[model samples]
Target: MTQVTLDDWAAMPRNRDEVSHGVLVAAPLLDIRHQQAVTRLAYWLDERLPDLVALAGVELLLAEEPLTIRVPDVLVTSSTDLNVRRISPSDVRLVIEVLSDGTVRTDRVTKFSEYAEVGIEHYWIVDLDALTTRHAQRP
Candidate 1:
């Protein structure tokens, strides 16, 4: 198998996928509840953060050399990044991951670590199943 670079991942069609530690993986299949939760959270965040645009289902390039990329359920970024191909950690103000049955651990543990390591200022894991949200801020 060949290594997939960030440029390769970026050029691919806008499918919700992830490049994890140099391997490609499909994003969790979002159910109706998951979809609704993402939409609601984006709208709620957008209203509160006027300068940043809350976007849903956009690619976040966390790393470059090893090509770590993830598509957050909702991400808050500057309006200037609205038309960009991928939102880097520096450009992302906040990222929200809506937890589904299959992605609870990923959103909670793996992503929690990845986002922090990538320098995202704020991260929120919304667990719809548990009806709770955990917010983390980088110190």
Candidate 2:
């Protein structure tokens, strides 16, 4: 299967795709449990952390040249770049991914390493089935 690149993915009129190492990864519709997890987390962040912006399904840029990008289930960013099309890793304060069956490997191994490598302050994973949450802080 041929996947779109970052530029093409971004330019498309409607996009629900993420780029990992310049290859577009199509995002499937989230199940109710996954959606609920994201909504609850976003609400909690909004209520408790009024200083930061909490949003669901925001595109985050990890690298420029290789064009790696991810659409976190929930992302917390400072109020600085409110209207930008895509978020830079540096601006990202926290990113949360509510896992589904298809996303287990990528979210755990690939995204875990990538988020840490970029120095994002915090990364969270919510596994509804396992009823577990993992929070990783970059050092």
Candidate 3:
């Protein structure tokens, strides 16, 4: 049980020049539409579900800390987990990743495996252009 701060991950270079563990990583920049969609979805969920009071968007989950667990799009959790600032993967009820140009492969493959490893119940990948969402669950 180790705690990895946002600063630790942020320290990972966001460009090809910067390298971590001898690996070069390029961080994906979120688009305006992605932000808007997240906000709209959160608001919509809030209106419909009272139990799910805290909906987080693109918030980092410190589960398996030092791994820099960040999820895009949307997340909905129950009141019991609301008071805590950082949440474990098991606490996450739903994870929605809105696919973007840079993230389609990572979203469809890497993240899918990670979320499942952490025991996420429901997962979704939304295709913005096609207006379709792909769903998966832990088995």
Candidate 4:
């Protein structure tokens, strides 16, 4: 199979899919609890950080060449313009991923490393099953 590039991923229809290191990964549908978690988080962020915008399930471009694109369950950014479909990591202030059975590994490992590598200021992982939230900040 041919490797997928960021341009190729961007051209495709917006769906529950992500590209990590040029590999396509399918994301499971968000359940009610998952959706609720994302909503609560977004709301909290909006209230606390009025200057930043909170978005759910938005595609973010973390790297280039062998592209890495991720769709965080919740994202907080200062970017006001919505014309761009994919946002650079530098523009993002925080990335939140609500843990689901199908995405635990990717969220905790793959995405964690990717986000850190790109210098994302904050990363949050919300575990609905455990009813907990884990926060990580770049060192």
Candidate 2, poorest ten consecutive residues by summed lDDT? 130-139
TM-score of each: 0.89, 0.87, 0.70, 0.90
RMSD of 3: 5.4
Model 3, range 1-139, lDDT digits (tens) per residue? 3344456656753331222232334556778997787778778877887766536444445343334456446776764746554556666777777777887887788777767766777777777787754455452
lDDT for each residue of candidate 2 in 1-139, tens digit (9 for 90 to 100): 5545667767776655788876777888888887888999899897888788899877788887677878899999885767878888888888888878788898888998999899887887777876755555453
Lowest summed-lDDT stretch of 10 residues in model 1? 130-139
Better of 2 and 4 by lDDT: 4
lDDT string for model 4 (41-139, tens) is 888888889789888878898777787788999999889887788777888998988889888888888888888888887888877766654566452
lDDT of each: 0.83, 0.81, 0.62, 0.83
Q: Between which residue pairs do clashes occur in model 1?
A: none
- What's the true lDDT of residue 66 in model 4? 82
Candidate 4, which segments miss by more than 4 Å at Cα?
132-139
Model 1 TM-score on a 0 to 1 scale: 0.89
TM-score of 2: 0.87
Q: Write the per-residue lDDT of candidate 1 for residues 22-130, one digit (tens) a residue.
A: 7888876778988998899898888998688998988888888788899999999975847677788888888888778778788888998999887887888776756
What is the full ranking by TM-score, best candidate first? Answer: 4, 1, 2, 3
Clashes of each: 0, 0, 0, 0
